[model samples]
Structure formats: structure tokens, C-alpha cells
Target: MGASSPPRVTGRLRRTSLVDQAIAALQAEIDSGAWAVGEKIPTEPQLVERFGIGRNALREAIRALVHSGLLETRQGDGTYLRATSEFAGALRRRTSCSELLELVEVRRAIEVEAARLAAKRRSDRQAAELERLLAESAAAWRAGDVGRLVGADVALHTEIVRASGNAMLLELYESFGGAIAEAIRTELLDTATYSRPTHSALVAAIVAGDPQAAAAATAAALDEVRIGRERRSIGQPSR
Candidate 1:
């Protein structure tokens, strides 16, 4: 009999589970402005030692930040931080209702396209999820719960965008997540009516997969919200 071949040895993949540590180290550097936009990151070996992790784990952490658009990598050059907006500066600048209206107008443009795409491309699973969220929104409105209503509203619109099956559009929407949520809370929740037929109409249009009707219903709902804000402003005593 031929000599039995030596049992093949399979070495387990060695990896660091210290993902959080690596993320924290890099986040601290970014927060401290040590890594400015366009600045190339340190080499993989350097990062491994700096973050005290195996090369594989460090690479994974970098990959996560890259997906979030905070970092970018070049095939041969190096990874670099992407330019980020200074949200603090934006907050410091006062914004008027007119500006808010313009923001809503932009949202309308984006959402109209999203709704159209969703109507044409959404899978059965996505449609069902949209219906579920709309039902939740209706229940919240009937209960006069602004918080729940706003949450449901955000989820419903997010689902619509997701159903559009456009990665770039979805990414753009996610980038504005915080600002959009705040806008809904300050603008819509403050003025939304519990008995508004427009609310139901919008949900119905989305459920029925009627993109044009969805767009119209959304516009109408926003119009009423703008009117409510105006009325509130007029009713307030002069400061």
C-alpha cells in the first residue's frame, strides 16, 4: 500500500474581534481633525500597530467606514477621508419657514421619482412592507400620537425609496437621515391633523401602486402642513 498521505492541516483563520476598538481609534482621529479630507491614511501595517489589531480586522473596519462614505480607498495609493459637511455651521445659520418649504419641495421632487420607480419595480415583499407601515401610520394618526405617527411616516417613506431599487438614491436619502427626521418632527408633526383625509389618500395611493396619485397626495398633504404653519405664525402675538 502506498504510504498514507500526511493528514492535511487546515489552520483556522486568525482574526481580531476588536472591531469596536479599531472604530473608536479611527473615529477619535477623525473627530480630532488629525485626518482631514483628502489626507491619505497610514499604511495597513501602521494601522494594525496603531489600532492594535490584526491586519484582517483593521481592513474590515476600514471597509465599514468606506461604505458609510466617510472614507475612500485608491487601488494603489491609500485610503482617504472624504469631505464632510459642517453641520454645526448649518445649524448656526437661522432658517426661515420659506427655507423649510424649499426643503420640502426638494423632498417632493425626490419622492416623486422614488414613488414612480417603486410602482414599476417594487417586489411583492416591499409592497407588503409598505402597506404594513401605512397601517401603522393610520393607527398612530387616529390615536393622536405625533411621535408614533412621525416614526411611521419616516419608515413608510424610507421603504418607498428602498423599493425604488436605486443604490445611489438610497444612499443619498440615508445621508440626510438626521436632518430629514428633524424636519418631519418640527414641520409635519407640529401641523398634522388627525382627521386629514389627505393622509389616508397618500397611503392609499402608495398601496394601490399609483405613482401619479401618490405624488399628488403627497403634495396636497404638504400644502396643508404649510398652511397650518402659516396660521400658527399669524396667531402668535408679536414678540
Candidate 2:
């Protein structure tokens, strides 16, 4: 049969096997939670070392994950873990409109109490951390870096939740992080609204050890989001 076709020599099968193995290895990294969503993944060389595979195979694996919505490549900004999986990606996409408003409400409920408890029980170290994040958020706001602004706000609020000394509450807030990020970004896109999280007030309250003030400040921050969303939905100009 045509000289046995030279034993059907082809690197195709080997390449396919290597790509598949790299894909599997990358999945394990996502599932392990060491690589978080929205965080940039390691460099190509680092990934090659991590997967013990060729660079080409790793690129194919990353491309596949990107096509699957699990990764995102930001043109010279490096690749980021966009989602834990396809299902999570779809879930995040669906968090909009009324569902997102409901989530904001949920955040208000959790964060109000968290700020209250944090004010009553926070350590000096935690308070300082909150102050640091507040300054970072302010700087980001001034610099017009929406991503950093949202990140700092998220970290600042998470610190408040952490100071509450309630592990369960902190976990819940962390789990909602992706959706919350979307909400913050959307609101921030409307520069006219400018309704940002009340960082200075909230941090001041927490630092001052005033439960009522801390809770009030948190509520005010979230209320800005809600009010802006409502005005936009009604096609009204920002006040």
C-alpha cells in the first residue's frame, strides 16, 4: 500500500496530545483558585515551565481557554483569567439590569452590617489597611483609572467585611466580587454620574470606631450606585 505510507509519520498526533495535556493542567490551576478571575496569568515562559510542555502547545492551550471564555488576552497587557469556567462566565454575563440591582441590594445588606460590626471590633492594623486602600482608590479616581478605582474600592470594602470578624460574611462578599466589579465599572462609565463609593467617609468612620457612622457611610456609598442607575434608566440627567 504505497510502501506503507512511511508508517504514517506525522507530528499532528503528538502536538494534539501536548495541547490537550496543557489544557488539562491549566484547568487544574483555575480550579485550585490560585489563579483568580480578572487576574493576569503567568508569562508564556513561566507557563511552559509550569506545564512541562513546548511554548507552542501552551499557546494553543491558552487560545483554547480564551475561546472558551475562561481567559482573556488584553493586547500587551498579558492574559488574564476571565472566569473559572464557561458556566461561571455565562453566570457573570447574566448579572445585569434587575438581577444586578438585586445584587446591589444584597451588598447593601451585607456591607451595612459588616461596617457596623467592623467599627465595633476592628484592629488598628485592619483600620490602617482600610485607610491605605481608601487613598489608593482616591488616587485611582484622580488618575482616571477605572480598573484600579474599582479594585481599590473592592479591596477597601472587603477589608471592612474582614474587620467584622465574620468569616462567613467575608466569604459571601468575596464570592460576589466579580459581579460587583461589573456593577462598579458600568456605573463608572457614566462620567457625569460620578457616583462613586464613599471611601473617605467610610474609612473615617471605621477608623474612628463608630459603628453607626460606619454603617451610614457604607449605605451612602451603595446608595450612590442605586440612585445613579435609577436616573440613567429614566433617561434623566445626573444631578
Best by TM-score: 2
Give TM per candidate: 0.56, 0.75
Supply the global lDDT for candidate 1.
0.68
Candidate 2 stretches with Cα past 4 Å from truth are 1-24, 31-33, 43-45, 53-70, 74-78, 83-91, 192-197
For 1-239, candidate 1 gives per-residue lDDT tens digits of 99999775554322333666676677777767787444687888998887777777678888877766667789989897653333422421224666566656666777778777777678889878987888898888788787787778878888888988998997666545444555677764554544347756765676677888877877776666556656665675211
Which whole-number lDDT from 0 to 100 does residue 65 have in model 1? Answer: 73
* Each prediction's whole-model lDDT (CA): 0.68, 0.82
TM-score of 1: 0.56
Q: What does candidate 2's lDDT look like per residue over 205-230, in tens digits?
A: 98999999999988998887777667
Worst ten in a row by lDDT for model 2: 190-199
**CA error at residue 111 for candidate 1, angstroms:** 0.7
- lDDT, candidate 2, equals 0.82
